[model samples]
Target: MAEPAVRYFFGQDGTKLAYRDLGVGRPLVLLHGFFSSGAHQWLHSGFAHTLAADGHRVIVPDLRAHGDSAAPHGAEHYPDDVLTDDAFALIDYLKLTTYNLGGYSLGARTVVRMLVRGAAPSRVIVAGQGLREVTGKGGTVARYLRHVFSHLGTFKPGTAEWKAEQWLTRTGGDPEALLHVLDSVLDTPADALTGIEVPMLVVVGDRDDRDGSALALSRTVSQGTHVVVPGDHTTAITAPELAETARTFLRDQ
Candidate 1:
């Protein structure tokens, strides 16, 4: 099927947000990672299609400052837990009383924040993140992104930072707005994991350890399962197994 047309909604702060709705069945909201849009992360990778095919009404949003969403350059536009707030706004706009939620990397982190703050999605898929990242203890991913943005032109060819910068350029990320989005990242307390009463799945690549241990993060959730797929943080999202694993988890009840 052709990709669903992008839709618009006003956020709690009145900023226009962009999202795509597809398939029909249980509502499933998937958030993309930082510096990426729902189209680039989900549509391009064919991930949303697989899940939608499996009896889900997939809703993927371009988080504020990413994709077709409104990207305000001023720092004042972003408040603490802004992404989390945006997710809640989308849910409210869709009038989804029951649904499944999932995301990757920065998006995955946002999913954890939503749960700790009391989002009751029937099932959840947190990929490419670990406990330390959620608890604000893992600064590796944030630090790396900051380094790339802060020293934009300084990275040498073939270096990791340069590679990231190249990817950011390809994604058409707004550097100024994304920096502010970074400042809004919320760190959930380890103790808050107890409050998540629904089934949660933590999927991490076998070679990925950027945000620490995915297994450890899964163990913290009362009803969590950890799945190890192939590839690292960057490559993992494109892995076919990633989509299959998520589809299976979401279908298992």
Candidate 2:
């Protein structure tokens, strides 16, 4: 399939976000993982191309702090609610009342949160995420900090070497921002999951480092279907098998 041209838009808070519009079926919105842009996760992964080829209108966006989006100055600026609001804003901006939603890792967490908050889509796909693990002790902020510090010197800001840093900085990488996002994720109300009425697909890689947690989360959704594909977390999004499985699920829905 030909690469779909990407378009840009502003979220409610005025942060610039970019996404790709592909194919011609039901709208399928794809949210990418933290620190990774939509292009890197969806476009580069070949997932977007495949979905477009399968006739699904794919909408892949760079979340507020990542990719072509404008990075604001504080972590608090990227709170879960704000992120959810961004999704809604995007949908409204596109004049889409209902569509399908999916994401990987942090992106998946965002999808679940949006669902909990009543950001209803036609169907939802939670890929490469296990909320059970995320809601545990550390939450996204602590885990991200660990990943950042551990991988320190491995990436630089600005150029490709600093992609993660660029994202972090864009979202206002101060201590306050970290605490805000952490608290939001850890304290997400339980009633949120129980209220969702749409079909849900929980996907994870069999060989994922986070498999145990992902499985635990899949069990939480009231009307969820689980699929274990081959490969690790990153590969799960890029692998042809996983992409095809997602396409099938969306089509069946």
lDDT of 2 by residue, 1-253 (tens): 5566768888766777777788788788988886677878888889888888888788988776566666666655665467677877888889987689998887787888788767778888888877564455325445666566356467654654366555556544443333344444533454566667788888899888677666666676677778888888757887888788888888886
TM-score of 1: 0.96
lDDT of each: 0.90, 0.73
Q: Assess every candidate by TM-score.
A: 0.96, 0.81
Give the local distance difference test score of model 2.
Answer: 0.73
List the candidate 1 regions with Cα displacement exceeding 4 Å.
210-212
The most accurate candidate by lDDT is 1
Please give the lDDT score at residue 92 for candidate 2. Answer: 85
Q: Say which candidate scores most in TM-score.
A: 1
Error of 1 at 156 (Å): 1.8
Query: What's model 1's lDDT at 155?
Result: 88
Give one digit per residue, the lDDT tens place, for model 1 in 1-253: 6989999998888999999999999999999998989998898889999988889999999999999999998777899999999999999998999999999988999999999888999999999998888888888778888878999989899999999899888888888899999999989888988778889999998888753478888888899899988898878888999999999899898
